[model samples]
Target: MPNSANLGHKKKVFDLFAQKVLVVVGKGGTGRTTVARVLAELGTKTGRRVAVIAGTSGTHFLAKEDPLLSFSSLEPGQVLISYLYEHGLGQLGKRLSSTGLASIISTAIPGIADLLVLAKIKQMERSDAADLIIFDAPASGHFLRLIATPKGLADIAAAGPLRKQSREVLEMLDDPTRLGVAFVTIAEETPVKESIETMKQLKKSSGIVPCALFINSVLPSIPGNEKVQDLSFLESTSPYYQAAKYMRTRSQSQKHYEAMAAKAFGLKPIEVPLVPTVELSEDDITYLADIVELQIRSKK
Candidate 1:
């Protein structure tokens, strides 16, 4: 049996997992997939059923054998077919797809593919298919359009199933308790700038802001009082000394950008340190998850 304090901590830790949907987006190469994977793994630690749905990528990097964590990726063509079937247009969907007309149709209708994909996610939420659904979205620019599709359609359609579906999705976007959005960025000028701009666009387009921002691959500072100037003589003779100086310089640079990001987003960013590994092992993910759990716990 757990003590009162232990139980309370557990509840606080899992409060983030209580959200029905979490959407992650970032500039390419910022490790949005890694964050999604870690979130899914953490949710399973508490016996929650978690699934990661990829918008433009595959979920093969996730733990395939984990019973509590399921994975899926969305292909527009397939989603459109299934969506048509669900909405009573199976025959037409089949005819268009079989003759390669589906691509043309999708291109002709802006946001149709996005709407269909969102409809599938909406269905999964309604049917209780998973306790937590994490959507690994495309690059931030594309994601802005993906999320804005529902409202655009709703505004244009006066009365129809299309309008009804659009309104439902908009409701999900507006509900913070049901849906949480997070952005990831590296400690660099371009990514930091793009993240701020994209976040502002999301707010302008939907009146919704990200719940959290994560700064990935932050260099950990080494403890030392010895200045690089004091070690200049050794740096001329030793590669090891040169490497240390480079890292110290890089770490300082990262801090500069990290502070800029925090001020622009108006949220203290969660920093995931750069792991010293050629390939991330399970332990590395667990270590990062511990950071996320502690951060959430502190807030609670």
Candidate 2:
């Protein structure tokens, strides 16, 4: 739970984590990973044990070089193998998925992999390791597949032990008090469109409305630039004029899409500024986290 004193009006933002899980979703390249990182840091700031679980492709955001042990990859292969170990297949678990046949078989199974994927997150929630878990979910399309696994499994294995397990996971997922979904997107067309589409499907299939929407990489307004229009006098061929003019036009365009995205999601989108760095450093991520910290307070 968020420490109210620490939040100091930031309660609503950070308090969402008290629910146990937040799965970050959006189209690829929309900075979902960055949003996850910011949220994780916020969790820690509010004095909760936070863990960032990323899909396979998102693992690199947490490097060995980084000292945070609170980050991990939600690889399905590892999930199945670990389940075996937990269920008394200890020795077999070690060598089972190591085999070529086992790898292909798990992949070939229709919903088995997705089952383990959700199961793994549920497993983390069930454990004592962390009180707050942030899943930097896979891309929108794949995330939809992952979210549907439990219900699909329930329909097929209605009476077996598999069905029982599915029921337990579904209970957690279906209960918004236990799990929350958040979308990460930019103020661009494709990502916002995909996000809205996914948001609709997510609500229809999972019965969970997103807890929040984060619009990443928004341009910060330069002084006197937000309203600037007639810059043709500086010489249209000049790179300086072109850059300023482009920024002005693009910034305005982003504001339009930002408003549309917020309206479509029916939630105010938290805007994160674009960083002027080649690669994000810890300082950069911290800066972003600080910016996002405002969202919590404002909403509170």
Instruction: List lDDT for all candidates, in order.
Output: 0.73, 0.71
Error of 2 at 61 (Å): 2.1
C-alpha TM-score for every candidate: 0.85, 0.83
Q: On residues 21-113, what C-alpha lDDT tens digit does candidate 2 reach at each position?
A: 888887778888888888887777767778888876435683333333388787666666565566677766565544454466465555555
Model 1: lDDT equals 0.73
Q: Which 10-residue window of candidate 2 scores lowest in summed lDDT? A: 1-10
Per-residue CA lDDT of model 1 for 1-300, tens digit only, reads 000111122221235554698888887799988888888878888999998888784544746578899989875566765666766766665655542555665666656666667767887888878999988876635446757544665653345666777777778888878887888999899999988888887878777767777778877766651376677568465886777778777877777777777777766567777787987878888888887777656645
Q: After superposing candidate 1 on the true structure, give the runs of residues whose Cα lies further than 4 Å from its correct spot.
A: 1-15, 57-59, 85-99, 155-160
Global fold similarity of model 2 (TM-score):
0.83
Return the top candidate by TM-score: 1
- What is the clash count of model 1? 0
RMSD each, Å: 5.9, 5.5
